[model samples]
Target: MNTNQKTIICFCEDITKEEILKAIEQGYTTANEIKRHLRAGMGECQGRGCMPQIMKLISQKTGKPREEILPPTDRAPIKPVPLGVMGKISKGNQKGV
Candidate 1:
């Protein structure tokens, strides 16, 4: 635990604790707003990697409770499927479904 090292909140996005706090200082008080500003929870893991910590930071900075923190809605597909695999799902091409 090197005290001088920046704490990484979002491993997928490489978002640092200081960066999130800076967003807070700039007046982005809510977790989702901060996520939007910093692109923190928009990475590959879709916020599972960072939203909780972001919520914690937001709660600490703004006196908001964790229960009240709501992460942004995930727009990406929950699981990725190969294009060819998806093509197999058609009525005539049900071979690989």
Candidate 2:
């Protein structure tokens, strides 16, 4: 690894500072926007680990307050699950469905 390389921001998604900077340069100013553009917060941890860092970066780069950079919209299945479990649920074998 290069000595000057930025550390990994999102371990689950393998996002780095350079990638986030590039996305910001491309006009993704908000946390949600950057997530969508770079898949930074869509990983298994669901941004639990890197959201604060991302928010800070966005705030610093865009001159916005940390509170102003909203977090990404959380969807159903907040926790990570095996793909096969989702397949079973989709197939209607889920207990309630």
27 in model 2: Cα distance from truth in Å?
0.5
TM-score of 2: 0.78
Which candidate's TM-score is highest? 2
Relative to the unseen true structure, what is the C-alpha lDDT of residue 1 in candidate 2, on a scale of 0 to 100? 58
Off by over 4 Å in 2: 1-3, 83-97
Q: lDDT scores for all predictions?
A: 0.82, 0.89
* Candidate 1 stretches greater than 4 Å from native: 80-97
- Compose the digit string of candidate 2's lDDT tens values, residues 1-97: 5769678999999999989988998998888998988899898889988888999999999898888988889877889878999888989856685
How high is the lDDT of residue 16 in model 1? 97
Provide TM-scores for the models: 0.76, 0.78
Query: Over the stretch 1-97, how does candidate 1's per-residue lDDT look in tens digits?
Result: 7788989999888999999989998999887788788889777788887888888888888887878877677664655657786556665656654
For each of the candidates, the C-alpha root-mean-square deviation to the true structure, in angstroms, is 3.7, 3.2
